[model samples]
Target chain A: MSFDVNQLFDVNQLFAEICEEDNLFAFEGTITSEEINTILENVEARMAELQIDLKHRKKIYNITVECIQNLYHHSDMVPEPLVEKLGKNYGQFVLRRPGNGYFITVGNFVLNEKIKFLSEKIDKLNSLSSDELKEMYKFILNYQKLSSKGGGGLGLIDIVRKSEHKLMYRFYPYNDDYCFYRLDIVI
Target chain B: MDTLSIEGTAKTPTVRFDASKGLIELKGRSIPENSIEFYKPLVEWLESYAKEAKSQSTVNIQLEYFNTSSSKCILDIFKRLEAIHKNGSEVAINWFYDEDDEDMLEAGQDYESIIRVPFRMMEVAAG
Candidate 1:
């Protein structure tokens, strides 16, 4: 799983390029608990400054919380090859106003082996109707054990539920052993 | 027993639990990164309070937003209240939501459906 960071394009550069259209904020690096708090505060302040309605602000804020927490957990699963250069829990996120609604895009490096599992999870969530998703959320909340990181496997489901939109994602292969995972959430 | 009063933070909620009057109040947002860690003391308080339970218990939950992990911890809190109710004390759970937040209302309903304890969904104007 050893590969030079030069083989793939710089993650920060990629984020900057894609987020040029009305990007509110784009951040790349380690995402720790402290960072999550700061990010949430910033998002809230920015949305409030725009005078977004309470309902929409709450929705966007909740979605952002789940997205950043997901990144905090999954981003740590970085491939061994890039660990030195990227560091643990390396992640990036962009929040922007692309059009009528807000969009949140989060990216992280992950092992290739996890790509299938993550893809299937999102696809299954996208396939279900709102009611079904609610049921699934309740089922997991009642039965699943929270991981050491305090994740109950309900982050993605909560994101889809709040957004009321299909979950969109992409996995760009960095090498045979690792892939840069990007998830797009519309709110 | 000692009363539990914790001021809310950016990531946690304000908690006010009084065993003498059997009153519990949880207000503000609950989006802690580690919900269990933040809620363990409160949960432990509930367990001990359940033993010498009062005749009537009133619980008020007012939350702006809670992450998935907090949601699970919330359910655990409800279950503990349900036990107290099943053991012969009267327990009333008031779940307050913003007037326009259907999701919060539904979340309260979902918890009511699962836990045997009675719940009153109160709609409040968004502040």
Candidate 2:
């Protein structure tokens, strides 16, 4: 099967759709390295929109990059011919100003079987305190033994640790074989 | 043995290390397109710095945030610094964290506990 590049991707439209709502600052289509750069540029531009200092901007920028990359790396679409022909698998990310801090949401499709494991992992992560999370991260780093495409077993742990709030996620059925997983990390 | 300084971008952090001044600073965000490529030079510079560092050196880390891959690179940096410190030169690491940012503070403590260098945890007012 082939997907039209134009129908599959529209960077500006995605950005506008994400930023159109009140309190929304920026957005990006498909979390690739190039997309990451554009997101960073939009973030630099929106620093003034959000009226935040350079340090805050820096932190937010880092958090957004981490969040987006997680989406890119952990997305369910694999190295398949169709996805490759489509150029990229699109994931949605949004950063919204929520009072004192920003709320970040990144979502992409995942295989149905992965949701249970991910949910269980998040539940375990959610149960831990910061210190416990650190300990768990260390243990995972030393013992997890399996490296993702990014060579780190600590992505979810890092995301949970960085965000002040609990990691929120949703799973929506995309088809019989896959479901869309949305992960939210508020910074 | 050589000093390296790079400007901080929205996605990547600013890195400044002067072996001559004994001051190494890593500031800004770090989520490089390729974490290995971005950090390779910095790690190599540190390896050389460790070999030829002066009597005492202090590395200051003021990263607002970093990704998981960058976290690994950071651990590698800290381990190298620890090695340099063990070679009889005084090494002190100061990690600056924003007030109320328990995450960064805890991360600093984690690195401190793991590495053998003398690490000081300092709090700076959040921006």
Q: TM-score: which candidate is best?
A: 1
B-chain TM-score for every candidate: 0.98, 0.95
Off by more than 4 A, model 2: A1-23, A26-28, A52-62, A76-87, A97-102, A141-148, B99-101, B125-127
Native contact recovery (fnat) for each candidate is 0.74, 0.44
DockQ by candidate, in order: 0.81, 0.40
TM-score, one value per model? 0.94, 0.78
Q: After superposition, how far is residue B95 of candidate 1 from its true place, in Å?
A: 0.5
lDDT of 1 by residue, A1-187 (tens): 2334565656667787768978887778889989998888889898889998887888888988888888887788677766787788899888888878888899998878987798889999999999999999889988898889899998999899989999788887777777888888888
lDDT of 2 by residue, B1-127 (tens): 5589999986678989998989989998776645777888999998888778889898889977777777777888888888898899899899998887666887788887778998999899865
Q: Tell me the lDDT of model 1 at A147.
A: 89
Which pairs clash in the backbone of model 1?
none
TM-score of the second chain, cand. 1: 0.98
Q: Which ten residues in a row have the lowest lDDT in candidate 1 chain B?
A: B102-111
TM-score of chain A of 2: 0.75
Compute the lDDT for candidate 2: 0.73
Per residue, candidate 1 scores C-alpha lDDT tens digits across B25-85 of: 9999999888999999999999999999999999999999999999999999999999999
Interface RMSD (Å) of model 2? 3.2
